[model samples]
Target: MAAPVYQAPPMPTDAEIARDVRREKRGRIGGRGALYLAATAFALFAALPFAWMLLTVFKQNSDLYDPNLNPFLYNDPPTLQNIGYLFAQTEYATFIRNTLLVAVLVVVITLLAAVPAAYSLTRLAGRWGESLGIAIFLVYLVPPTLLFIPLSRVVADLGLRNSVWSLVVVYPSFTIPFCTWLLMGFFKSIPWDIEEQAMIDGYSRIGAIWRTVLPISIPGLLTVVVFSFALTMHEFVYALAFVTSSAQKTVSIGVTTELIRGDVYFWQSLMAAAALVAIPIALLYNAFLDRFIAGFTMGAVKG
Candidate 1:
């Protein structure tokens, strides 16, 4: 019998391969376009409330209360009356100053405590570091509501009651744990060999951390600072519980306590204060957004 004829499978032509590549490229482009559209929609959705608040800031009292006009649109030309009112009529300036001072203090305290604690847990603790990091994080997960009562008592006992200093003291209880956890992840992601080399070159562990590790960990530090600042600025329950005086109140408490009276609401001035307070934070976040995301994501995954 004749040997069966052997045949090779036909090879894909270059034209066919090119067509397949083109189809795949189109599919990827379409998918990316859809993703962009979806993201844009979500951003708009998230921004709407802020936009409304901003618009309210510029609206006159009449325009603000007008039922016939669109709530989201200005019926009349914008006015600065609400903005002027916020600065002129109320102790808004004091609130802003108090909030700023408290926020700065909290950020400073958090960084001071968290950075060292994080470095110790991640670099010095060896095998126990990871467990310690998680344990610290778990503390952060404990509801502030549960702690506020005891914390209020502690603040009173410590003579911190009704002072911005009270917030400065208590804010760290929450911020430090999260900041330390965040920094621990960031610290773990740093290669140990760099520190070892620094030690070999006559630097102590702390020196290496200061000169080598810290310089490289600016992003992580910024993340902590921003987080701590935002927390202090917006924290309400503790601020409300600890402080009753308008002069000592942070913006969050001040705006609510001062602007809203039972059934009456200073909607325009309230929104104006909200917008003004948010602007600095929004700017800071936007400025460091890339670094924040990088530090947070890398630290989270590696840790």
Candidate 2:
């Protein structure tokens, strides 16, 4: 028999390959466009309330109450009267000062307590540390309402009642538990080999943590700071329970207690206060957002 003629497999034509490439490029563009649309919609949904609040602060009472005018647009010229009134009429400035003081103190206390506790739990506790971390988080899950009654007596016994110092004392109770849990996870995400290497290089365990772990954990620390500060600023029940005087009231309590009277709302001033309080937090969150996300997500995943 004659040797069979050699045969070659067929290859795709250039036009066919080009057509497939175009189809893939179009699918990718379509997928990306859908994602962009979805993100835009979610951003607008989250931002519209803040936008309305901002608009309300700038709006005059006439424009605010006018049903015929567009609610989203200013029909009348804006004025600074509400901002002025908030400063002049109420103890708003004092409230701001008091809140700031409490927040700063709480942040300091939380970071100091949480960092060491988290480090010990994550790095030193051996195998029980993971379970203990979860247990600590569960303590945070205990509602403040449940603990405030018992805590109130302690505050009273400590002679901290009616004082801003009471807040500095009480705020840490709630803040430290969650912060410690958060940082335990964060610390776990750090490699143990790095610390071991530092120790091998003559650094003490504590020194190793200070030099190696902390430098890498700035994001986690900032997340804790921001969270604690925001909590201190907004905590109403404890602030209300411990403080009665306008001078000691935090921003949340001050705005609610002073701004509205007998169903009449000072719409503009209330909105202005909300805007002012929210703006700083918004700025801080935006600044640390990427790091915050990274810290929390990595910590959770690793732990």
Candidate 3:
């Protein structure tokens, strides 16, 4: 063994090390570039429909109806005729107003009912909380199509038939249950120690909730608001069943009914109406995207 001693291999040179480092950096840059390219592709794909709608809203009917022309490009000068027709010839403004009113009222009502229900189920309801929470969530799964007939009678009895107020009344029945379940997940993710610490500082249970729990649950609340508002705007079954007057109609019903006659369709004006309503909601979703994702992901994992 003593006679078998040998010299060790030499260390790499400065040039070799520098070359390897550059190679690694290049690999990382290539990976990041690929990821960026993929992300950009996905963004464009998602935006394609919106871009098409925007273009169609301004396109002339002749260009739109032409079979030989490129649908994606303008074959003629853009005009505001479709937009003007939407505003002037339809009850689109009324639809928007009614939709907004219902959305706002539904959001408010859902928050009021859901927040406390979620907190109670999460904290106060000893061992039956999960069972009760699931039962409430099951109510949301019942289709509007099945319930609309009975709901219509209730609406008529309340004299809210053919009124926008009927939507305000009916929308919350679904919104509250789902929102309560959603908020429960948020509340569960919050530590009990935070509320207890607030209580130790002389705050009552209600005060602790108001100061500590609710503030921490802002993301959940925002999720509720967005869900309620979107549902109210898009709901057609109940809206159609209970409300028939053009003055009481929402965007979902108004656009289809007003713009589509028995055989004729106002394609450009319909697209214009859709673009107006959809663009703002899309912007809103983008604005609160982080919070919305946090709300859903946290709720899903925690629940």
The candidate scoring highest on lDDT is: 3
Report, for every candidate in turn, its global Cα lDDT versus the true structure.
Answer: 0.91, 0.90, 0.94
Worst 10 residues of 1 by lDDT: 294-303
Reference-based TM-score, model 2: 0.91
lDDT of candidate 1 over 102-172, digit per residue (tens): 99989999999999999999888999988998899889998888899889889999998899899989999
Candidate 3: segments with Cα more than 4 A from true spot: 1-34
Root mean square deviation (Cα) for candidate 1: 3.1
Q: Tens digit of lDDT per residue, candidate 3, span 251-274?
A: 999999999999899989999999
For residue 133, what is the lDDT in candidate 2?
84
TM-score for all models, in order of appearance: 0.92, 0.91, 0.89
lDDT of 1: 0.91
Indicate whether candidate 2 or candidate 3 has the larger TM-score.
2
Q: Which stretches of candidate 2 lie over 4 Å from their true place?
A: 1-16
Q: Whose TM-score is greatest here?
A: 1
lDDT of 2 at 137: 83
For every candidate in turn, the CA RMSD to the true structure comes to 3.1, 4.2, 3.8
